[model samples]
Target: IVSDSSVLLCVCISLCLAWLHGDPRKVLHPTDSYGRFCGQKGTPNAKKPILFYFNILKCANPAVLINLQCPTTQMCVLKCPDRFATYTDMQLQHKLSKSYWEYYRQFCKPGFNDPNKGDFHIFRPNLLMCVCVCVCVCVCVCVCVCVCVCVSYRGLLISLVVSLVFILLLRFTARLLLWFTIIAVIFLLAYGMWYCSMELSQLRETPGSDVAIVDVGLHTDLQVYLQLRQTWIIFLVSLGLTEVSILVMLIFLRRRVQVAIALLREASRAMSYIMSTLFYPVVTFFLLAVCISYWAVTAVFLASSNEAVYKHTFLVNTFFSLCQTFNRTNISKTASCLGSQCTFAFYGGETPYHRYLFILQLFNLLVFLWLVNFSLALEQCTLAGAFASYYWAKRKPQDIPPCPLFSSFSRAIRYHTGSLAFGALILSVVQLVRIILEYLDQKLRGSNNMVSRFILCCLKCCFWCLERFIRYMNRNAYIMVAIYGKNFCTSAQEAFFLLMRNVVRVAVLDRVTDFLLFLGKVLIAGGVGIVAFFFFTRKIPVIQEEVPTLNNYWVPLLTVVAGSYLIAHGFFSVYAMCVDTLFLCFCDDLERNDGGSEKPFLMSPELHRILGKSSHSRISPLQILLVWDKCLPSSNSKMLQVRIKEPKTTEEMCHPSNMSVKILSHSGHSISRGNKSNTTTPQVYLLTSHPGSVLRFSKKDLQSTAHLIFQTHVHTKTA
Candidate 1:
């Protein structure tokens, strides 16, 4: 039997060595070392033949194993364990005992799992979410009571008021509430930052372990920390700035906000829309938290033998703590359900410190709830948005093709991008494979060389199949579906071929228009700054501003320059945000025509030549304008367009230096500018530091739309 098994192993190894070069043939050799046989034959006339190493392996206990690692080589042994030898040998090798293999089989993950795993990954805590939204309740309550109130937006006041009228309520002193929330948030964030900084930045700091990936969650439990490190760091930083800026802006614009609010009694529309969009981000993570919320109350639930799972769970509680702190609530119920779905347990046994992990979630929650209000203003702009939406929507609507110069701009962009979708398929697949491998590698322990190798091999094979499959799906969808049973990559692959994403982003963003807005903002801000400096200089008229004496001329100059940059950036950001809102209004519904002219993807260069396609695809300016208009309930009657023609001369077409853009907004209250004559000439373009956003002609021409320009900040809105 041993001799037969040896012979069989030799035959498999030799076949694998001959066949394995890559993974296109993995299916052909599912269990054996098929990878060993992948390669290509060189010229038939070549003198030397290529050689490959074939590792050998054998198992002594056939009755207790289905497969075994070869002693000499890590080749899989086709062994059948004894207890299930009858059943196991009928499947694979007749080497190992079935009992041993069966025992190990229990460790393998179930073939099928929750399909919702990949869909809409929301995090947790229903009660906590409800608590976070209490500010909304206050608004509604104020409205119902006919009080001069801030809580009339978001329907929160209505919900809370009704609840209070019928049920007992708990309240806190305003001073105590503010102080507690602030202290707790800063504390949690500091701890999280410390833990992640300590573990992730230093590779040596990671503990020696069999399991992997912890430097980064609660709901996904493990994977969240692995994937969302960059996003969270950005969010935390942005959150601080946003809260601070909003509060400052509110203080400065309080009377303005109040006046605006007074003008519009029905200021709920903007509040609803803004809140909905803002809430979406939290919903994803919070749902994950709720699933684990049940584990919050009980300490025994988290006991795990697997140190990786244990540590990861600790991180999850930490994350949940942050979230809960932001809102101020306990999320034990959420933890329980997530705990069930996560099924986090050690592979061998349970943890001794299980109880400690459970309480960690509670402590984290307490901290999060306590710190939320001070560091973050959860509802600062609710009233402003409410007024903005209500006032804008109730205003008169007009119709005009207000911007003729921007006509066909989007179609040009679309034509350029849609043509290249096919060529980018390979690159996209490669990128996707890289993402997958990175994910797998991060999830496993860095020290487990064997597991890492196994994972890498599997991923390599997976990626090979995926690449071919993407190609196959793009070319012959039916053939791929007929053979692989389904076609999947065409839509995704098509999006990559052209500069579709870039073109759409730029056009929908009205990036060039935004640049013009930023230029104007900088000009005004710089002028103001110069005036202030001059005023300071005159106060000490003999101070000689340029003389680098006690007054250190460079200090003021540097400060002014830095201050100018900051002001310019701030203004630019505001303008960019408005422009984004405008662009989004245009492309909101034209999903296929979003980036460009709704052209089908072009596969061949011949098609491109015949069609006379542009280098990138773009949707029509009008199309985008319409979508943006729809999204922004405030600017229903207005639209702006900037169009650059494809210049006949190579200098004009190829170099942005010669490119001219025409900016047109409503001459009146409508956008129906289909038959307008030329009142003013096109604007001259100038380059700016922002590579894509070039400046346009003087600010005097766009003074009327100054408010629009001020609100056009992309950076601020995104932040």
Candidate 2:
């Protein structure tokens, strides 16, 4: 088709050129392969078919050889090879003749003269929008954080409100109720005096008499009794009653003072064991959290039956809610996380079985979060580990040495015991106030009828509290020695001795503070007793008698209460002194047993109290490792919402709601790499000594509910 058109164009051009004298050039049609103007007699109308044949031939398969002849009016065109014949590899066999595939190769090259190798950039608006989006998210996060911080810092109201909310949510609280009591007492006293004055004025004047008349009497016993009016007798009786009341108050105050002294004296002893208690208000909240946790845990362990489980759980929760606020004080999760701890971070002991405890711990945390969403939490993540990590990260290797924490049990005992004492002192004050309030309310309402019942109740309460303290102390003592050592450590004993010596040196306050406290007691006692006497004389005309009644029951009863108070006060003071002496004796005796160098004492009231009681070393906080175990005790039917180490494998459609557990072998042993006893060590070398194994393993935290726990394994020899 191209040849025919070219022949026609050539003939026309030749004839026209002969007519017009023109020149011809084939260079302009370099892209065209068809023979240019070969036949001079070509018609212009036949050019279309020649061009179409040239296009078809250009795309023809190279594998086939085509032989063709064309007329004088036709044009010959060579075919271009198929585009699929491009060279993937430079190997010679697969290569095609370069010329035959030129059009195809050129077409595949993308553009006729693209200098940019596929790296060519078509127009793109720069994605500043993406950067803008990233910037916006960052800005949003930062703004939210800033707002939170600003609100937290700016609002004292927030602090106050949160504190109040937390305090109210607590199950046990020590509230300051003195302001209300003092106000009530002041108003009552004012009202009583005003009423008394009115009554007395009316009594003095005869009801129908125009003027007040004085009854004339000669200087007889009658005149003496009426005007001076056995009132001197009333005065003497009141004084006696006042003395008795002072004595009783002195006793109560004395005990409180003694407990406070004991706590101050033993400050070095009880740091670790105290169950940091919330005030009464939020005790319920804490309890609620525990109950919720337990309920969820129980549901998982006992999967199937809903009736028995829900019924029992409800009853338990109700009982827990109704329980006295004080009962919620001592529960702690610190012991459980490290229970059955392995020898090293990545190692287990005895059995070939491998347990990735840390992962298991994650499960525990999951359960905890699921069960108890909100509570006063001490997360293990926040404790010593984070600070240690941070400090180490910042610190130089040369600067590092030992980070000594709590090293022994004797020391722990002393520190924790002191803490307990301090806590007890505060608790005692709370108890005293509570009793006083209860007493006042009861007497005013006449609920118990007996006026003396208030004192009896107070005494009973005191006894119960003391007993509880002793029991707790004893339990901790046994546990400490078993877990760590006989004492927190040996230096602990020396510290106690030093503490005692200082206490003795500062004996100056032995009588001073006591005297002041005694004064407060005396004032309260005397005021109450005299006021009562006045009440009986002026107001209660029920037991009226012509002569001074020999049978004034109020006098004898008041006397008994007062006398008991005084005697009890004095004797208890002596008993307190004796207890202090006992503590001092123990310290002295222990010192002699140790044969350690003694230091001279520095006098201070704190030192004196400490000396009087006993001296013990302080516990290094490091020794007291706090672990997070968010699991319910097995004694409870409900489990805490924590992942169990043992996953339930079988479908427990049959597992009853109340999980029945049986005890299996629960045994433990301690393995120390070094010498077992470092007992007779001196102070300087003491820190270097290889103290044998101190293992605290427990089966309580294991997946098996039936296994026994080894709380006593390291501490004692079983019978």
Candidate 3:
């Protein structure tokens, strides 16, 4: 037996070696009994068939390999059968087009050409049957276990159902409240417009003769009064049309609006989740501080270098002007004056100060652009990292630290600085182009020529589209960099590809999320406006006395609205980013995990539960794996030893060290050596080491082993 085993091992080794070093031609084209190649018929004074030669030899003699006809040399000779008149030189030329070494290097190795010789390839068609079997078994087991668990926990199930019902009720109530608010706002605005029109008409109808004469004397133009009345009428008509349009939109696009609202809620929830972390606010403030400092320094540098004359000569005035530009305020009057002075200073003064100022301004602009891009990139990176960390913790079911924001932020600055800078540079260039185009468009609007205006309009539209595309790409790239630690270009390319691959899903998600955010902004701004209006009107007694003096209530209301919008945008932007980061992470998780026991999903349990419910019929493999994992003994238990027993029938074959003995009772089949006991020894199996072998133990067997171990320990203690 030993000799036979040795012979078998030797044969296996020999076969492996032969496969690794064997010639392809010898294996593919064997010689027949007549000592001729299988495909060849006769031998003649011609060249040997090129197909029969090895790759190495064929590469050395390229000319011979290229020519199909037999050579004049005695060693290179061949002849074909009479029926093989369909031979063509084109076949040989095609085969020898590339050197044999190159072809062999690509399609074949030195050894046997067996594609399945490497690691287990899940994509192989042959594995489909096995995968199907495993899937079906897993599904069956999961269903049975789930049913049993549900039956055992009837009270919990009831509570879950009640909670779901309550949630649905709340959602419906919220939607109704939103609709009511919209209607109320519309009606109030309409009433205010009607009142304004009535007052304007009354004023216009009152003649100058009927007016009360003042001590200083007063003059009135009837034409101006009439124009004012006309304006009121037009405003009333526009307001009415707007109300009608809004009503039509509410009726026609109710479903879309609801979806947008739902998406916004989800985005808000995602944002809140991140903000709940302790360090998020700290990180946000740190970034803000950096931006503020950078902005101040940049402004100072530009202001100090200005040699142009200003109405106010102090450098502080120039600094304030720069600040105004940074805030996106319309400082066209101040800017125009500065531009004219600068040109005059450049040509008339022509001093070193003027030249230095020009250089400084250019340098400041570039630095400002860079800093803006960097700040945006930094925020995105930090937020993305925080979201990714949260996702990782949830997916792995691990206890994360109270605040990992600093760690993530530091990593982003250290590892992703280059990527961030690149992204920022691209974004800055796009923004600069957009600004230039907008300026040109504004200038063209003043021109009388229609063609120039039309051209500028087209350019503006194209640039707007381009700017949006670049921004989307840059945002996604930053997220990718945060998650994967890739370079800017690679991350951007990958992000583009990922979006392209899932374009429809991305489009739907983006539209839904954007609408939801837009609605939130409107709600915030409008709510502030309404509150301010009521306070100004003395409807709120608590704050009526504290109201500031304003020329009109509308002025204060509009200011509050704008302020509220800006605040809302700042707060909600973080949430919107969180939503985007989580979404990309989710997409990556779907692609990487196959729902196998070995490859667990990296997503939250809540997300998994939601997915399971939605895809119950076509349950993901990961879900099935999760179910199986739950059924298994907890990996956290260190007291239990897991063993895979080998197949064996003889009791002696099992090692003594590997087995434990225990006493048993005959009547109850319990372990007790002292009284009413009978020895009922359980059979044991040996263990083997084989890659392809799987050892499965019955639940009954495992239970018996546990019982035996317990009894043995007890018997020893008593003795």
Candidate 4:
């Protein structure tokens, strides 16, 4: 027995030594031919324990192995390396390959791997530590909440009511503004029409006489006549179109228009909500930089690829042309150049200049599409995060979720690349088609062939309508993707279905919202233009005298208007996106909850409460009582009980009139009373709660149902 014990002790000691040393295969240092450590030259630590060697090696250092060891008396420890630190080729090649670097650069640290210099590391130090901290905070919060609830529930209730009231007041103010703007727009349009009619009538009397008098040595009477004729034609056509639009709106599409306007209003509200957060401006600026960069890159590519062809094409000259037009430069000189030098500019091109220009335009179209799509996705995702956070905060006011803006934005850029690209590609193709049609129309404008022009016009109109519809659908689809994390197609289909299901609501809300937004845009742009005019003319009077050549106030007015439009678009686009997102969310909530007792509303309590109050007056008392009762717990039997007086007449008994049902017990049982006898008037009671439990009865039987019973009521009365 002693001999066997000695052998077992020896084995146990060996195992302990092995464990302390750890497995040889797990060691990080390279071994020599004799399977010994490749020690530093002339170092006395060559024979140091392998456990100590690994303990100093950094975590995530490719030079280090998977597992490390320490002496049995000490704990094994590893220090994480700086993520932004440079690694040796050997280290990176072995552990962090090229593919891994690509992923790391994209998701882990963008712009970090630039050869010139590494960016600052922005990653969280330790996920585990963060999680632990968050958990502790939540626990503390819960404890604090419990104490508050126990101590001052009444105070909390009062505060909540005050907040809700403030919100209601703000909502009311917004609605009043919306209605005021709509009425203002209508009046403005009417006044403008009256002014236009007066001007046109005056113009008809004068015609080319005024133009001839204004024409200097530059133009003859013939040129004046042609210009006046063209102006008249354009004005008449515009007036006719406006009249047609008004007729169509008033006669056939009034409801649809209203719906569109409502949708716009909703969008505006959503925009206000989203912009209220700081994340919006940050995301907007970032996206704007990205878009500008993309545009520059695309322009460079197009210019570099087909320099000669692109130089003469609209692709290169479009912005310049707009600038020239805005500056009111001599169009006659431009026209002369177009007829002479510009016609032969592409003659010496290597490729068919038109084809090359077409290809370059196509490439640009794709780039623009990608930029727009990416920006849209970014905005949608950010808004989604904002909406989600808002919703979560509303649902659990004490435990608000963290701002998910960056996280959601990153997720969208990473996961939804394909969806974004696909959506953008579709829209880009449609836009390209529109561009082509416009180019064709411009080319054919000088042609007198009415049939071709008419055909082009019809095609353009159809495509314009189609484009608007697709754009709207695509936008809503993006909202769905943000909320539900679905692919583009699935999200689009779901959005379409949701819209269809709530068509009436969507129509009414959409039109009203759109009109409100339109009114806001007009007000903003017009107000800015008017203010700018006064500022430039009256405030800066020296500017008019100093720059006499710039005599036209029209140019500055138009510039201000254009600038205001851009500003409004930027500001309102965010609101529009918010509206779409929230509307979709509201629609989703309706589908999921159906305003039933079985499911609570997913909307914010304030919104739900406000909407309920607004619409409550329209609902019948029975519906309100029934729905309220259904939502209540069965423990409130005193409130649920209702008594109806038995009828004394034989005719009433035969008809079984004025029967009232009272929910009596927790087992889905109800007590229904009716008079079954002519003289004694014995009460007939039913126990089942189901609607089907009642026997077939005429309308008269239901009409006779009576008063509800309550604890305060001493006698039954007719309902």
User: Taking the tens digit of each residue's C-alpha lDDT, what string does model 4 give over 96-163?
Assistant: 45554543342222123442232333332232122223335789767654553333333233333432
Weakest lDDT window of 10 consecutive positions for candidate 4: 69-78
lDDT of 1 by residue, 235-315 (tens): 456646644654564467544333222211111222222323323224323533542442232212222211322112222
TM-score of 1: 0.19
lDDT of 2 by residue, 186-260 (tens): 444445445444544554553432222234334423423333323334444554564455456446665544443
Best by lDDT: 3
User: What's the best-to-worst order under TM-score?
Assistant: 4, 3, 1, 2
Model 3: per-residue Cα lDDT over 248-316, one tens digit each: 767876765665454434334444444543234345556657656654444343333323222322222
Residue 444's C-alpha lDDT in candidate 1? 61
Cα RMSD of predicted structure 2: 44.9
Residue ranges of candidate 3 with Cα displaced over 4 Å: 1-273, 276-363, 394-398, 440-454, 548-555, 605-719
Model 2 stretches with alpha carbons more than 4 Å out: 1-500, 503-509, 512-535, 538-562, 570-574, 589-688, 692-719
Given candidate 4, what's the lDDT at residue 595? 35
Clashes of each: 127, 69, 9, 28
Question: To one decimal, what is the Cα RMSD in angstroms of model 3 from the true structure?
Answer: 38.8
Please tell me which predicted candidate would have the highest TM-score against the true structure: 4
